[model samples]
Structures are given as structure tokens and as C-alpha cells.
Target: MERLNAFDIRELERLCPGGVKENVSLAAISRWQIGGTADVIVEPSSVAELCSLRAFIAQEGLPSVVIGDTSNLLFSDEGLRAVCIRLGSRMSSVHIENDIVHAQAGVWVPFLARKIMSAGLTGAEHTCGIPGTLGGLICMNGGSQRKGVGSSVVTVESVDTAGNICHRSVEQCEFSYRSSVYQNNSEVIASAKLSFLSGDKLKIRQEMLSILAERNRKFPRKLPNCGSVFKSNPAMYEKAGPPGAIIESLGFKGACCGGAQVSPHHANFIVNTGVARARDVLTLVSKISRCVLESVGHHIEPEFKFVSVHGEIMPVDEMLKGFFYE
Candidate 1:
């Protein structure tokens, strides 16, 4: 690990009163339960702390990345040199104001959905079963049943790369199927406002339960995994059916590589059965992608982001190395 300069250490201390944890295990934080360690992992207690930390990193010329729950992320075993800025628990708050719900980025998605439903508000029911932070959902444009969170998003507040706060309306966000303006932009989402319709408590609860039950039935609760591996490409789905269906049809379900395997219930899900590595997950993903392309002529793109040991973004092919090795 590279040593932090005295100035950098002082800056980190000044910005995040609580000193950052060095060489924090990435496996412990990510859903995949795989990867090496982050050189520096800082949990900022408040928005101001986050802003200050960003400034410190910039001034120190250190690489940094902001992450939420690490649900849909794959990190290399070689570890990371970047300072990972995770929003502290203090940011996980959800508040209701009439028909709108304001949620901090660190708030869990399922919890946020429950809060909205408890307030007798509808439209968040589809998110009842998703696992991720509200900020991650917004960044990924997360959705189910053809309705995305962005559809209900009225406004978004984020911090740009320069630590400047920017507020944008739904119209300005440029939301697509499973992506938003935030996907490529180096902005960090702080909070969002979602609009909902008034509904009966019983009706909303029932809807939430139905979605939850469906997800539970399809995804195994015991295994650790990112919810879905590939984005649903409607065009590809129309031409060759869904990615899951194609992979399952090719007899890839229950396929195992190291500790990672494609779920028997849902081929789209690659599970970590106790001790899987990031390499194992990427290998499984590559095999599935190859099989899907050969069988259905569709190249399924992965939904997760791959971070390398050096804090550099990993290429899809490099991340999938050793996937075909027996």
C-alpha cells in the first residue's frame, strides 16, 4: 500500500474528524462478499463532512470514489488504492412531506419503500424487494415491472466532482431504461424527492407484499449476490427472449465456478455460495455472456461496476479473466 503523506493525513483528520479506516476489507462491505481491501475507507458523518473530505482528497491529489451499499459492484482481488467515501448512517433518513417523500442517498431502498407505504403513499411498491441504497437506485435508474424510480423522482440534489451542490429536476436528469445522467457523470447524489399517489393502507401493503414475495421466490435468501447481472434489453428480449431465459435454456443454471454459480431459480443471478471471489463472479458472468451471444446472438452487458486494485476502472474482458478455466 502506498503511504499517505503527512499533509494528506492531516487533511483527512481535519475533514472527517473520525480518522479513516485504512485497508478496510471490501468483501465485508459489498454484497458479493469478495474482493481485497480499500487503501482508505472514509465514512463521512454529514454532507458537510463529505464535502470537506472531497476537498481534502482533491487537494492531496488522491484518487477517490463514492459508493453506496456496494450492491452492484465487483472489485478485483488485487485491492484498491482509492479512498472510498461511504456516506455514514447519519445520512440514512427518510421523511414524508404531504404527498412527497424525501430520502437521503444512504437510506436503504426496501426501508424507504416501507416508509412510503406506511405513510399510505403508493408508487414505491415496485422497489419493495430491491436491495441497494436510495442513491444507488437513483444512479442506476433502478426499476421493476416496467416502472423505474426515476419515474417518481421529482427532483435530485447531488454534489459534483468539484464538491459543488447541484439540484436538478426530473426533466433534466435524462433517465433511460436502467441509467440516468448520474451514471457517467462524476456527481454524487445526496438526496432525492419522490412523488407518490395517495392510496389505501391495505392496498399498498398488499402490493408491497406481492412484490416482495415474488422476489423471495425467485432469488435465494441464503446466497449473497447482486440482484440482477444484466440490464433487460427490450430489443434483445424481443429478438431472443430475456437474458435469464436464454441462459437457462442453455443449461447454465446451477453452473458453478469456484464458489460462484448461476442461481437455479434465476439464471440472471450469480450467487456467492459462502466463499466466492470477485474473479469467480466475473468468470460466471463471462461464460453466461458468451453462451448467450452464441445461442441467441445477443451480447448481454453486465450491470455491475468493476473497480481495479489500482483504483482504475476495470475493462469487462480483464475482469472476466479465468472465467473459462475449469
Candidate 2:
């Protein structure tokens, strides 16, 4: 708290007004309902305000993070000491021009899917069941194997740390398997232009409904959880089917650590059974990775991220040994 005052967080409030918040609980923002309080949270209601806030953070050399729907993220028990920027409803909008659908960063992927369905767009049906923001979906290349969200992207609009806006073509988006240029974490995704094919409205709606049903069957929705615990690499799947197959083969489905439990419905999902802490999930992930590696000679990488004890956002594989609490 003292550190916040020293950094003059009030100055940010002066700039953003009704947008800057202090001592925010991360649990409230994330899907898993985990983590402690953040030092500051900024919700930029518009793109201009978002750019201003990003500029401020950059000029101050302050630690900061941006959040979307937070379906794929987990925060540490220590919480975030950095300023966290969030895109609110005001920033979310979906517009269709012919066969192109334009959406802001804050638009939910599922919502976008529905909007596309209404517009008779076919390319984004696979995104209907993926829980994330348009920004996060593009950043993580999030979507199903049959049709990832990356393919629909035609152009990307972004704000850099210097507060300069830039646009990138689909080729420059550098989309690959579960990865994209946005992974650099150096830009704030503002909006994206998605090109799609025309389809029968009824067909698009039916496909979206089918995908949602399949997702509901696979995901443990009753429990609090990040979508998938580990990224299912091609080689891993080639040798062991889906990531869930590997976990099931290793006899780890339904495994529990403290209040965190691996979903019996999906081995790739780790859910909070109640009273689960960041440490519990971290420990479980480490143990599972080690077990999978030893048993199959293949390293399983975590898909979800955790706020490290160092107060940095990091994947499970990158954390320093002994840096996490047992």
C-alpha cells in the first residue's frame, strides 16, 4: 500500500477518472475466483482512454497487466502488485460489413460467435465454445483444432507501450499452432478485422449449438476452473491421443491436491473444489508434469498461467525451481 502511494497512483486516477481502482481483488475478475488483491486496476472504457493509460504506465516504468475475460488465467495467492488494465463492456462492440466482422478487444468470443451467426458468417463457428476475449483469443490462438480463431483474422489493430497505434496484416500476425505475434506481450490489442465466408444462418447457428454442447460435456462448468491445464501438442497427441488421454493413462484424472481437483470429466482441466489456493494448483501442475515426463518421456507444458510469487505472470514451466511454495 505504501508503495502505491509512493508511485502516486492518484495521478492515474486524475487521468482516467472513474476508471482507476486500488486494492482490487483478482478473484473477482478471474474465472477460477482465486488470487488476492491487486495494487491497482484500470478499466479503460474507450480505446483513447486505454491508450492514455498504457502511455502512463510506460512512462512510469510501472509493472502492469491487462486482463480480458480471464478464462485462461490464474493469479497467485500473493496477488498482483502491478497495475492491471481491464477492458470493460463499453469497449466491446461487434460490427459486420459484408463478410467481414469487426470486434473490439473486450468482446467475448462466444458473443462474437453469436453475432457472426446472426450475420450468417461461417468462419467463427469454432470460436463459439472458446471462453476468452477477442484480444486473448488472437493472442493465444485460442479455438478448436478443426478451425482455430487465427484463421479468421484479416487485420489486427494494436496500441504499443509508447501509445502508438499500429495495424498488421494476417501474414504479419504470425499465427501458428496456439501462438501468434500478440504473444510478445508488448502491445494492447484494440480491435481485429475478421474475414469470413457467407453461410446459411440456420446452419451457422446449428454448428455453434453443437460445439457448445460438446464443450459443456467436456468442461467441468459446475466447478471453478481455467479451461485447460496443459497445451496439447501434436506429438503428445500423436503418441497419446488428446492431452486428457495422457493424464488418464497416467491415472491422474480426478486427482486432488488440497482443495484443487483434476476434473474426472476432462483430465486437462484443474478445478477449485473449494478453498483451493494458487499454491495448490501450482503444486498439482508440477507433479503432473513430472509424472507425465517420467512415464512417457515427453514434457507436458501448462496452458494456463499463474501469477508467480515474484509477482510476474509466468507459465508453470518457466518458474524457477524452489521459487514456488509447496
Candidate 3:
């Protein structure tokens, strides 16, 4: 990784033209509201601008990270060393052509789902109330009620690690559970085309509203949380039921580590009660994982990516090491 200086902003301005914000608080952008600062936060207005920005970062040897909506992510309290790129609001348009819906990566999943429903399209109603952008949804293969977004995806257009634009169809995406091939590929999703069935607008709206109501009832709004913290492996829960049930049975509900607590409304969610640090959340998560493993002989994997410890962003490889090793 390389260090960035004031001079780099001049080059970034030339590449993006819209300018970038320096030393912006990551907490403002993240759902948890607990991250430190991002050295530079660039909101590129167009695909060309994004490409130019990537090229400039590579040429200048500046460390960079691209994030969308920041729903399933945890940033360090120490802060991030890399330049963070966020797609501009101008890139969030959703277009409907016949039965195909084309959505920009920056468009929120709920927004897109509403657009689809208003257009009398089905299949997307299940995504109602899901936080994050369309790109993050597809990248994470986000699902609800046993159905995932990948099932409706037809194609995706993204910028590869080398700054080359590429198109991948659903066949090439390799989506499973809460992950996709793009998870480790360093590719940034720009847009996606989804195929949906033509349906009654009134019925679609009703169904979507019902789903949202159910989600609100189950996950409530009393505390700040990133939905489910761990992925449920069926094999791990054969004797203990689902991960949530296992956690609930272990007397972990309302379990607190510092300011982080297991949400009483839902056992799977670890909420930031108030003034919670990244380490506090991690400590609680570790305690839950250990308790589950010790009591049920099963290790539950985390769904969200942990970006840092105290104030430092852990390397991606190092962050993933424990899951595979122990």
C-alpha cells in the first residue's frame, strides 16, 4: 500500500472532475455509525470518471477501496489508510424496458424493488426493505424468504481489477448463499439487468408491503444492526437448530461486550447499543462464535466483512485467515 498526500487530490480532481472529500468520517457512510475516517472519499459521477479515477490511483500508487451502501461491512475504529470510492447519486438511475429492469449499482435494493413493483413486475418484491445497493445485493447474492437476487439477474456489467470493463451473465456469476464469484475477484459491479415476470401491480405492492411489515416486526427498529451477523450452516445446526436458535438457547440474547449487544428482538443480530467500538463488536461476535462451538460443536461463520481492529484496517487475507484456519 502507498501513502497519499495533498498533491494526490489535484490528480484526483483532474480524473474525477467532481472533486473528492478528504478525511471524511466512515461512520457517516456506514450503517453501524462506528467507523473511523477514510483518508479520501471520491464519488465519481460516471463510469468513465470511475475508470479514470482507478487509473489515476494505480499510476500514483495510492491505496483504494470501493464500497456500496456499506450494509454488510465493519470498518475499524482506528480508521482506513486507503482512498474510498463511492458511486455518485447520478449513477443510481433505474430503467425499465419491457420485462427487463436495468439498475445502476448505486441504486438501493428497496428503491429498485419498489420501481419494479410499480412497473407491474414480479420477482423483485422479495427484496423490499433490504438495505444496501443493487450491486452489493448481487455481489453478496442477498436473499430473503429463501429466494436470492441472483435468481432474477440476467447479466452484470463491471470494471475488472485491471480497469477493464467486462460483462458477465448469470451463468458466469456463480452465486451461492451470501456470496458470489465477485466476492474475491476485485471487480466493481456497475450495473445489472434483471428478468422479471409481468404481474399485477396491486398484487405486487401488497406482497411487498407484507414482506416489509414482517421484516419490521421480526427485526424491529429499536437498535442499529447489520441484520444477521453470521451465516447459518445447516450441518452446524442439525443438533442445535438454526444459528439464531443456537445463539438464543445459549443465553446470549442481550449479551453485551462493551457497547455491543446481541439484539433481543433477534438473536442473530449484534446491535450497537451506543458508543460501541469495532473491537467491542468483534469481541461479542467472538464470544458468540465460541459459545456456539463449545456447546453445539459447530462454528458459525460471519456474514459481514470485518475491516479493522482498533484503528487499523486489517489486510483482507489476514481478516479471512481465522475462518479457514480455526
- Predicted model with the maximum TM-score: 2
For 215-268, candidate 3 gives per-residue lDDT tens digits of 988884777778888888978767668777889999999888888888888899
Looking at candidate 3, the ten consecutive residues that score lowest on lDDT are 309-318
The C-alpha stretches of model 1 lying farther than 4 A from their native spots are 312-326
C-alpha RMSD for every candidate: 2.1, 1.9, 2.9
Off by over 4 Å in 3: 1-3, 309-326
Off by over 4 Å in 2: 309-311, 323-326
True-structure lDDT of candidate 2: 0.81
TM-scores for every predicted model: 0.93, 0.94, 0.93
**Colliding pairs, model 1:** 79-309
What is model 1's C-alpha RMSD? 2.1
- Span of ten consecutive residues with least summed lDDT in model 2: 1-10
Which residue pairs in candidate 2 collide? Answer: none
Please give the lDDT score at residue 295 for candidate 1: 73
